[model samples]
Target: MPWSDHAIWWHVYPLGFLGAEPAALPPDSAPRHRLPVLADWLDHLVGLGCNGLALGPVFASETHGYDTVDHFRVDPRLGTEDDLVRLVEEARSRGVHVLLDGVFNHVGRSFAPFADVVRHGSASSYADWFVPEGDDFRTFEGHGHLVALDHASPAVVDHVTDVMDHWLARGVSGWRLDAAYAVPQAFWRTVSDRVRARHPEAWLCGEVIHGDYTSYVTEGGLDSVTQYELWKAIWSSLNDVNPHELAWSLTRHSALLDVFAPQTFVGNHDVTRIASRLREPRHLAHALTVLFTVGGVPSVYAGDERGRQGVKEERVGGDDAIRPAFPDSPSGLGPEGLDVQRLHQTLIGVRRRHPWLVRARPRPHTVDDTVLAYTLHDPDSGAAVAVALNYGGEAATATVPAAAWEPAAGDATPAAGDGSVSLPPYGWCVATAPTLPS
Candidate 1:
């Protein structure tokens, strides 16, 4: 599949974004049909310059969408399968691609096959679909209600592949394989090969938080994996007032670019909102500056562009705060959020204008405890973008290594003659070398 290097994704956790009940509704309860409401935000997302909608789990599950009860059906609380199809069509009409979260590593204890295993014991044909510990089945990350799937089972592979086929047939452009590291690499290779065979343009990214990301994209047959390391560095460095931390992480980021593009973001459904996570709120601009200028496909969590604040803790309902509901339409959003939204728009606009940045890697120009500067240059076209960040109380000065550069984005102003630039307290700037005449 050919990946859209230029894609800017807006990730939404639909279960929370739609204000759906946390627990599964009773069988007799009426369907809420909140999926259609997302259709109303298509224009808002397009206006933000996002061409991709990376939705969190939308499948039928027992509690949260991760505890899948059925891979083939859409959760009734959200809506019918038809609702998703209509939403996909609406998004496509606005020139946006839809990516679905595929949770194949685990299923709810109530999943049909697992329930059958529980009832019929070893006698059940589907018994091998799960791994048993003593008389109990293994669960995902110790969550007993979330039963882990036995990836080696042929039936399991068939069921998952068929689910992909069903959704792709309905217009899903790609799949974000959840808990991909938990499943064996061979299983992903088999499923990815089958999916690509059927839908050649299908993009597959894995939810791999740790381990050699290059191996998963190469041997494991994934196009990309989540860049959690850089995400942590972005917030942590700002909170600690340590730009060297970000510099070290960017060096590692540059190494990974040699392998494949990663799925990058500052906030997501599982983590604390970046606005609250940063010790200094004003650093939000610097954090987003890194997100947009870096070499990867970036995703904006639903409320992040609006500077929403929520802290994700380890207790029950920890994620609820981070994944709050949005109003039905943009008009309902408050006026106070417009500033943050405009910041996101400006940064994303810079990325759209310089699409080559998707492949461009950073070369460090300067690195210090409170200041970091680097240039994202394309060796092929000689195109370069210089980024400078200052996290100090006093204004800092940085010199661009390039012979000459012009301000492309940010609040810092460049000195007229020299390659020097002056950054105000907690300021940043993005500059690009002039292109030669074609």
Candidate 2:
């Protein structure tokens, strides 16, 4: 399985696309006010080799799309449903999939359906749509004015299923379930089976973070979960060049043991900016290299490709500054900009061309505090790729095993073998080794 064989999901957020707003917005307000200038912008993503764009409930007539006011219709403010339809069509034509954020976990307080239910005070037929916890299903402590919906209700179940199925029929590739863990695993299992039944080849990833990914994956509720902590660990190690710490941190992802695939990223709406965390361009490059060439799908956040470093978090004074408009090629620079333009383009090709990257395992021989070496082998296909990372502040060395570098006569790869690999300070190597199954 090449990387394309597995889904390397990416994202295009509405809040980030359009600048963040004040604390709130009216139901009739316009969000993502920048969609009109987004064609060439979006086209650039595909051009840079992103396979998909995880767009939102652009139905968010508000700041961030997470506060979805309407699930059935696209936000007229973002663009018309026809605009979205065209986006899907255009992206598909370029081999890009469009996955919308399904936010059934919650709805905006302004949502008409839920509002009527509140207004009618139980007399409304749609009252069962939300979690009936006294009079305040949409608010608590007077913050995050979101109406948590009831997934257990038949009406809600049917409604969500219908919504996903509708998009599937309209050629949407899949969905990114929001705050998936907050919803019961049983509900996800039900929705998963239903959606896959409708589109057997469809992809579904949960927003479950690293803390509970092992449990999440074991339950068979999501094909993959966001690798939040994993990305963070990798980011910290690469920036600091702490191979020992990186290796130690990666140990938490039990997915590394069993056959598992999850999404990896350095930053998103809720996390620290990757550039801010790891300032070295090469360090970031090294982390991203593992992200792509390692097992599982590698997700590139909007501004990650460019080295979007600025103030730290809001405390560090960099809350909303990183989410700037997609910068154009500088003079002769490529569309994704200079910082990571070539690296991303090149790695995307490498991932697309290699099977070991998609289906192989990250078989690290060891990470002895300074040197990190690993081999990826497609046990089923016998293809392999070896990786060596030097996390020491100074240079280090390693050697590849002969058995891992040559394929057996009748197999696609060679049998297991070992050798010491070499490396330089904070440097890494990505190369396919020949190998056989036996």
Candidate 3:
């Protein structure tokens, strides 16, 4: 879909980024290819300007790959199915973009049709594929091994539309879905209208979190969803210096960018490490400059561009500290993670030179409780950018009504003629302004 308006992603969790064996290997072991260790880091994910990878679960799970237990196999502890078709043909020969991670509303009670309905319970024939309860089934939020499926089963909508048309015909260009708000928004509008009538540029995205993400993307014919409320208002308003709680979630993220671009993130693989949820890790470049100047389809997570910290606690291997383990490549990392991987390759090369900031819509121009300021326009290419943050401790000045501005990427300064920007205490910026009149 217009190549997801230039998707950024780099997410990765492939069984703890290739360390595998957190427990699931024994359906007759011996196939541990470790997904070509992410096809040897696809040129370290295209030198970090992330053209999208976003994986996380590789099916056939019973452990953390979202407990799938075979959506047509492959988690033979992460190998086979020709090592994920040569890691999606070597991440589509370096132009990356993969996405996966489905987990259709629960399965993992040894999911061979819920272990044949726990050894023929309702005289199993996959007994309506789950959700019984008294005779025992409905688990998932209580996590009794996660069973609950049967989203008004039409054989669970032709087995999730033949496992999403057998993995988007084995190439994978999208699909995050996972507990998409406990399924059923008319079963994801009938499996996203039968997987976009045959992979019409796949890209599903759902893991909703809280409700009404624009009626789950117009009644679940979704194309994107997990903006987890601007990822908890950018790390709880920069760990409470509170730029008016990220200016009221960028005014509800500009009303969900008038209805779609929502896949944004800060530190994913289920939270904590934005360099250990910053209390002021120099505002981690003000949360990657409000995640590369707003709008959406952003990703990054894999060891969060190497500022890796990890926390995510709840119990039992608490997401093994935000999904750890990686280092079979990218020249075996660590030199304090290459200055946060060159500050995520300079803010993903300023979000790949502003690919229309993927629907630009922030507009605040100064909100307080420690300096904010915004802009982001692109109404059909009147290209604009202007951002600023600055959880105070001294020097500040973020003006932004955009009369003129330039600097284009952090360590803020631009003050030539009244667009004001000067922020020094925990500073930030993203400049390149001018378009402010409509």
Write model 2 residue lDDT over 1-438, tens digit each, in one string: 332355655566655555445334555666443454445555667666777787755664444566677777776556566677787887787778888888878877777878798789679998888866654674422445777888788787787788888888888888888888777777877877787787887777788763567666557456777777778778777766567766665555444436567777777656666777776655766676677777667777776666665444645225456555443322223544474766777667667767446544565665776666666676755667666766655766655555545321111222245455445556666666556335
User: Distance from true position, residue 162, model 3, in Å?
Assistant: 25
- CA shift of 235, model 1, Å: 0.8
Against the unseen true structure, what C-alpha lDDT does each candidate score? Answer: 0.88, 0.66, 0.82
Clashing pairs in 3: 60-70, 61-69
Which digits, one per residue and each the tens of the lDDT, describe model 3 over residues 64-127?
8887878888888888887887788788888887888888888787777778877878898888
Overall local distance difference test of candidate 2: 0.66
Q: Which candidate is the best by TM-score?
A: 1
- Taking the tens digit of each residue's C-alpha lDDT, what string does model 1 give over 160-272? 89999999999999999999989999999999998889998888999999988888988888889999999999999998999889989998998888888899999999899
Tell me the TM-score of model 2: 0.85
Point out the worst 10-residue segment of candidate 1 by lDDT.
429-438
Check candidate 1 and list the clashing pairs: none
Task: State the lDDT at 169 in candidate 1.
Answer: 93
